[model samples]
Target: MMEGTILTGARIFDGERFFDGHALIAENGRVKAIVPEAEVFGASDVTKLDGGILAPGFIDVQVNGGGGRLLNHDPSPETFFVIARAHRKYGTTALLPTLITDTSEVTRLAVEAAIEAAKADEGVLGIHLEGPHLAPARRGAHLAELMRPMDEEDLDLLCRAAGEMPVLHVTVAAEQVTPMQVERLTKAGVIVSLGHTDCTSDEATRLFNAGARGITHLYNAMSALSHRAPGLVGAALDAGDVWGGIIADGHHADPTALRVALRAKRGPGRLFHVTDAMSLVGSEDDSFELNGRVVHREPGEVCSKLVLENGTLAGSDLDMASGVRFGVQKLELSVEESLRMASAYPAAYLGGEKERGFLKLGCLADCVHLSDDLRALRVWMAGRVR
Candidate 1:
């Protein structure tokens, strides 16, 4: 049997803070300790890294596809594995395979696939269903015909799925879902997030009070924050108990806007980074099908973005590591803060912080080794290298 493993030679960031001249020890797929290098004396499998940062592995909650696989295209356990493996290369140790606005049959298939995949892969956290319950006006890439109000049947499926999976996140618009529905969904352990809506600030807050705790891809598909009208964007920033997810790709929201959000956001509920990644990530393809429509990757001078032929923004080509770099280099956030936005904050949003987001004792040994430039060099999930 294996005793333990020691990873040294890099600065360790334990989700909340940084430790220098320390070595991390892992055993039985959990963090054993983080001690000074001199104290790591026992015989163990040691992997020494060069000068860099060893931080908690990233947890992405809004990944639509990766490795050329789209959940909407193929809702199966194998597809989830493909997506997990693809994002794992970019330092994501755990992620929710997202499906954007699909039919009921496809949604049911995805729920089953996620339940099975969670049993096989620790990296497959759960599933994020980004709506058939959405506002048609704000449907960026989602087909308008598929958008509809949340009925009892829909709620029943989601509530049951939540009971069967580790996490079942659903995105809905306040206009499409009643507050009562939101309350029941939350009571059933569903992580309800508001998105793809044109609801007013008051309408959004009503849902927030009703049990919606998160805002998806903030400032993108929802209403904007204007002086006269604080839309969903304003409601999200102002709500202390609500968490917000931002794409952080330079193409989605301006760096200045993101910086402003970081400062203006309320406490206990801060803004975290999410890839909102699509099939373009970890793939060579420049385009993919979204709801039978072709979405092309348009190359920009600084970064590329996926858009439909009509020029509507699709998902994104961003990866978790690149999103972290953007938070630091573009948003002017400190390294520790940026890392937290990627790992700790999202994990907190999904209520997985106790195990997966931190490198403290008893936490899962999911760690990422990054270069000085913040690129992922090596990734380990549950103390085993991926």
Candidate 2:
């Protein structure tokens, strides 16, 4: 097989900036270089792209399912293929298959599944355990009955999983999990994220300092900011070293509020986009079960927009491509910034392989080709077109 190809003639976002007329050269599933179009004489094919934007393929750190397959409904290693293929069509070349609050046994199965998928060199970048360790007061769509504080067995399972998975992320509540536990998880190389909390800023900052590197779906299912008590939202915006993920699907957060959060994010770490996507993404079906409860995509809602009967947002019907579009068209984020949130920032947070996120020389050639309106047209992952 010819292992090299040069893709040309699109506006390329190199993570930091955009350049037109750049040729991205890939060989053997890795980037050779991005050179001037004229300089890209190659041993294989040279493909000319239609006018649009070309950016690094999105890396979603919090995806529940894709392609009409819900991970929680089918928590087996083999199911990752269906989910990965589903989300790939929407430009998420890499993702963490998120398992929401479930039993201990199910959690173990999900972790094993992720490890197996990773071993098979599938599109899974990691595993996100969104929790059985969440605060009941804030457990949005999570099964409150299954929720509880983290115990020793839970901690041990997580530690073992971290050792096996390329990346292991767990979402917990600040009040539910002690700072020492958070420290231990971080020490074990797990990306411990605080979520589903009603913690005060003082408690939130303390937890962040103790090793909670991130906050999940910021401003949702967590305490909102108030003058009397700057809550998790305030802490997430102010914590310079902590990353925050936002749904930004109009329902989860308002565009003006999203703009404010983005502006206020003082960072060595900043806010990034996550779909917190459900099974309906990249699929025609809009109804799925979450923990034995039916969650349906609202009528006529193209983004999926899954919600429970009581109108509780279960998970996003959103995909990475559409999330980027929301940022650009709805929130008015610069296309560069939107793309960064969907791709570079999540890769930076995972901190697994440096070659995974950006489209730099020596990096893996995971890329997305988008239409002018910001819809994903084609995706290239692991140097193969998908």
Candidate 3:
């Protein structure tokens, strides 16, 4: 028998849409039911929450660091838990600890750390390798000295370590990766994302046909949408089966540009948001160091760089919750649609929509409560409050 709990007075966002509701029945860390408060009379404990919206806990497919620790530096299980704690305070209940391009030694350490984090940390979803296998021309913020050609041994070590962890996303330059290499990783159950590249639309299409299903951080770190070439962004827009990640902080990309992406990619369900956040997340002061390079924080932003000292934008200071607010308020996206981009769409990208990313029976009891202004009030991941 499983212990049960009831959460009342939430306007539930069921991944696809929202409905006026008051109570949810949860058992064994899964959503058991969504019903009126009066119907949940027999629960042993009832949490009577006040006016707020309850949606599936936000999922960030990319997180670099938080709480003054860089995953690249620490790359430890404890470091991941630290990142998870910092973001959970901001309403991200699940995330993939990301590692930017680094030396093969650092990459292996980060992968091993992520594996251990997945085992020990409940909020850690998996690892996202941003890459050594990237194009030098597009390697923004990544140490050029550490970038390398994609090789069989590199792929084998990462794949073997990741095993079947929920999300195993790797960003690569399509031209840099051999077709057979892409197919092999794809067939091995890795979700290949095209990013940090200068591939043409034709090359992007060829890679997608080979098996890439995602575009990492949409407009950034890749060739732009050109009329003549149509570039990687163009190919991603034309890719009907592929999902794309948009950084909606109003800094990385212009609001109108994001709207254009949504207009092009928006169907019944597509398009998601990711906070490529850095160590500045959950902190007010902005300066940090990466790979021995000093990074100064730009004014009026969370994580934008003030100089090219690091030759990159660094990571973001934005979290998933504020991303929703930016998408809705600044980008003029509808609340319902923005919430889906924050939650459901990413789950679909991971092929976990049927189980996670929704406020429905049998789904993981992961949810966030937000005030009228959309600030995080509380969060629950798999029925455990954080």
Best of the candidates, TM-score: 1
Candidate 3: 10-residue stretch with minimal lDDT: 301-310
- Candidate 3's residue-wise lDDT over 1-41, tens digit each? 22576787778777776667668778888998877667776
User: Lowest-lDDT window of 10 residues in candidate 1?
Assistant: 297-306
Error of 1 at 72 (Å): 0.5
Candidates arranged by lDDT, highest first: 1, 2, 3
The residue-by-residue lDDT of candidate 2 on 216-327, one tens digit each, is 9988988899998889999888888899899978778878888988989988897888998888776777687777788887753336567899989888888888889888
Ranking 1 against 3 by TM-score, winner:
1
TM-score of each: 0.98, 0.96, 0.95
Cα lDDT tens digits for candidate 1, 1-386: 33688999999999988899999999999999998988875647988899899999999999999999999999999999999999998899999999999899999999999999998966998899999999999998898898999999999999998988889999999889999999999999999999999999999999999999999999989999999999999989999999989988888899899999999999899899899889888899988988778999888633588899999889888889989999899999999999999999999999989988899999999999999999999999899998
* Count of steric clashes across candidates, in order: 0, 0, 1
Off by over 4 Å in 2: 1-3, 41-43, 300-302
Decreasing TM-score order of the candidates = 1, 2, 3
Superposed model 1: Cα runs more than 4 Å off: none
TM-score of 3: 0.95
Cα displacement (Å) at residue 130, model 2: 0.5
The true-structure Cα RMSD of candidate 2 reads 1.8
Clashing pairs for model 1 are none
| Cα shift from native, residue 88, model 2 (Å) | 0.3
